[model samples]
Target chain A: MNTDAATAASAERSGSLLNLEAVVVAFGGLQALGGVDLKVWKGDRLALLGPNGAGKTTLFNVIAGDIKPTSGRVIIKGIDCTELPARFRPRLGVARTYQKTRLFRGLTVEDNLYLAQTGRSGRHLALLRSGVDAEFRERARAMAETVWLADVVGVTAGDLSHGQQRQLEIGMALVTGPEFVMLDEPASGLSRGERERLVQLLLSLDADITLLLIEHDMDVALRAAQRVMVMNEGETVASGTPDEIRVDPLVHSIYLGSEAGLGGADP
Target chain B: MSPTGAAPGRVQSRRTLRRLLSARNVVVAAATALALLLPLFGSNFFVEFVMTRTMILGIAAATIVFLAAYGGMVSLAQYLLAGVAGFMVGNAVVAQDAWSKGLKLGWNPWVAVLFALAVTTAVAFVLGALASRTTGIYFLMITLTYAVIGYYVFGSITPLSGFGGITGIDPPGLFEDHPQRMYLALVVLSVLVYVAFRVLAVTPFGLALQGIRDDPVRMASLGFNVSLHRTLAFTLAGFTAGLAGVFNVWWNGQIDPTSISIGPTLDLLIVAVIGGTLSLEGAWLGAFVFVAANNYLRNLPLVDHIGITEARFNTIVGVLVLLIMILSPDGLAGIIDRIRLGLRRLVQLSRGSGAGPAEAAAGSAP
Candidate 1:
């Protein structure tokens, strides 16, 4: 109801692609997101790092429209999409992969990408026309190749190794050609080589598509993201360039003081 | 670099149906040819009464399979949907007015059947819309509740269903007094419905429905409206059920209150599950099993020795259903798939490491 032109202008002028205004998520008495405010700018590769109970995923859920905030506004491109369900967000150029690999397991690698590509752009299917047209298959194949899955396009996602499944998860998110790609812990369970490949892949993504990811792997996260935001106890404790957050005393205490410490950081 | 080492046969089953000249397609074609020619070569009693009834019921059961297998919404209202068409047919043809037995339009059989189908489809959509919000057992419960309401409302309500229910409802002049012609018509209609279902099973809608079935949340994240897909699948299922309903009334020559009871409703689910909810062939298989059990099991000499008369046919069918549920929860389809997979493995072993597409195709027959 409050569609003020001034507020809209400020958000655009600030280069904010997503603006979360006083977003608060509460489960019974426990507040998962305690009045969090954040701005994700266009073409910004932002990494969200936090301790286990720091509400990083909760915040991601709120932005992704998977969870409704108790009270707040989620503005995407100056449009208040607070009430819009998660399914509608993809049309608005938002795509996300889950914390755990959520690829369609029964579907082949090509089929998974095919569904992702069609999710946002494809029209309501014609009854007689082939569901996966030549153009569609080509697009899916190209995407699979981009994700280093070209050779296994015919294989089911469930049969893929954990690392391959992760790659496929990212591929599924990117296949739709969304403006914002939110990946939750993309490097969580990969081998060192796989993580390095993942870092390279993230870095090579088109700059037009902004990236927001949550990662515990400090090395991978710092290498991939331009900016880093560390969360603690349902609040943004630190926000700066990756280098700045690396040396921030508050970030050190937050990381080192908690059970998930710097000692566990990947070499 | 294979993501999955298993053959492509698993995913291909849903899509392979499109190839008209494939081995599976050829087998289906041959079987259809046999079914069509049966009325000519076989006795009128077998073709007209038995096969005709089985195909009609098979079509109805297929509707259940469509919703259960693709949408993962195991609805119990498909038979109720068909019964809607039956009651509509009765209201249109035999009964003249509310003053008579039912809403007496006294229309021609063709017009009546069409009208009944349309009304049934609309009702199905309405039922779908209501049930789409629920999933799994909840969806089943909602549909079962509606089924109960429909059964009682159509059967016992004298105002809507005429005093003793509309009787002597016959097909058009072309089918009347011509059992073989009616059987042929039913076969043609049933085959057309099955073909349409097969075509739909390979379409985008069908694929999307399968995706939703696998992971509704994941499908939703991919921007597919899970509820909308479920509803549309249910409505499509309704269309087939309506066609079956029309044929059922034609076969029975009457539409009574008992025609839409819980017993018939449960039989629809039983037939579908017994055959294998995932395969289109399962519908006909289940129907054949059901009809055979009803016809022959009741008259078995063992039944008299067991102190169960011919009237207790359902008892035998019930036992068979229990056996199927316990032994193979996926029904006959699961059993058939396992057997095919085993044969493929055996053949590959016998050939000493030569695993060709031909062997794979032979294994994927079901």
Candidate 2:
């Protein structure tokens, strides 16, 4: 383990914001997530980098309570939340955006954000008051402004461009005031400008909010996250800062698939 | 600062213009006026039996529309829910005698209706609880199973099953022998049910239910209780179905096993489909079409000459339903929506191509 992993391990001993103790998730004969132990401290920005089928998204799903692990424990804020369904996790300040946009397509952008805002604070089960409450609308307006979608607030979400949809998804995750937000491939289909905007948005997030993101775009991921963990075949291959991981032999070999270019240089 | 941003004043004016140009409000006003004035012009059979029945049936179908359109939980057990309430009214109201068998308990009709509504609402809550955990076809199957169970349970009851089910269910003395008075009460009830549906649609609960329908996992992650919202939606639908059930018994002065059977279940489903599953107005239209077609189809000269009998009415209705489903999957409302959109586009196209710049600007301002 690198120094960062060592520190994260010690932080887990002291009850980190999120802890996965040898969590294993198997789908039939295929083990999507091998027994993996991980820790995310409060206010930490973690970028999970991996090739396809590396189980980063699976790990995310387990943490988000979408999938229960085959064995081991998932502790959120010092409480074991392995048994709680995904819906209950949100009340505990866990939020996530999907790889594919999972927005309410029929609803306007403002309405979608308003729903998220109200879900966090308003009486969501209220039958008399409209869902588009004044406070919620205000918050939605502010969030739309933050995501640069203010002008299109009335547009249905399905009608937005792909990049705008991704921005709106991120805005939705952020609007809930979640202590822990897990974003799955937020920069997957973005143009350069949209990716820069997303990186800026991620970087400018409140320090009190912990973020765990899965991204294939190494540039955006490295810039936005404080710590990076590279996984291969459902196991952690490397863990360190962006600068350390940039030159790591394992990372270089994993990405480039050849050790010949390195020529066995001493670190 | 947006590239596509139009002025707020321009948007508002365009919205107002669209509203003024739209024929929706005019149609609604005319329909409401015609409905309210129906009793003043029509015969007792037309006024009380046909129109009132249509409205009551519309209320029942509206429940399905609420679930299918908003919550995305299509159910076949809603008519069964109505039957439950109808049976409750029968069990509570009809005086205990040789005709009552073991069913009647001698309660007043008003009390019976209230008790039936409450019980059916509770049953709805139970069904909602069970059905909320499922979605799409599984949800439909669960409700269908429940409906089948209800049908057989009522069918097996010796006292209630005679000549299909219970009879001699009389309404209160206030409207005694006055079909017009009964019709008036039904009109009020139907209107109240529809208004309640409208009120619920714009509420937080309804919106949350819609969110759940569109994407359950997303709604769950956003902190909305998906199952709870679904259950609540089902319960609301059940309340409307229950009211229709009570009114149905009062109208026919009896309850029958056939009323809750698959035949009527399909009838309700057809009503929702034909009118438009997404709109209450569609439900009313479907009901009107179903009732009017059933009433008038056999009276045609072609039918009389070809020896078409009353028993073949369902066959004709079935063919009509199949034709409508093939032509417009979204039903009558969807057809109307398509026509409106096409007309608007044509108007815009004509203005953009031939009219002056000012006309084009006005048309596209919104």
Each model's iRMS: 3.7, 3.9
- The candidates' DockQ values read 0.44, 0.45
Top-lDDT structure, candidate number: 2
* Model 1 agreement with the true structure over B1-366: per-residue lDDT tens digits: 212536667546544454456655676678789889997688777788778888898899988887877678888998899989998888888745334477777899999988988998889888888888889899999999999999888866786687788777878788888878877787787788788877775566666777777777877777878788788888888978998898888888878778788889998899998998877788888898888777766566676788776677677778888899898888887787788778878987998986575443343321
- The digit string of per-residue lDDT tens for model 1 on A1-267 reads 245556656666879989899999999999988888988888999999888999999998888888989998999878788998888888768999888777767667877787776666554354655545546767888989988888778777788898899888888888888889999999877898888888989988988889999998888888899999889999888899987877678998876565455545534
Q: What is the iRMSD of the candidate numbered 1?
A: 3.7
What is the per-residue lDDT of model 2 for residues A102-189, given as tens digits with 9 covering 90 to 100?
9988777877887886665547888766435866777887999999998788777888898889989998998888889999999988
Per-residue error (Å), model 1, residue A121: 2.6
Residue-level error in angstroms, candidate 2, position A264:
24
Off-target runs (Cα >4 Å) in candidate 1 are A1-14, A130-132, A258-267, B1-23, B95-100, B356-366
**Which residue pairs show collisions in model 2?**
none
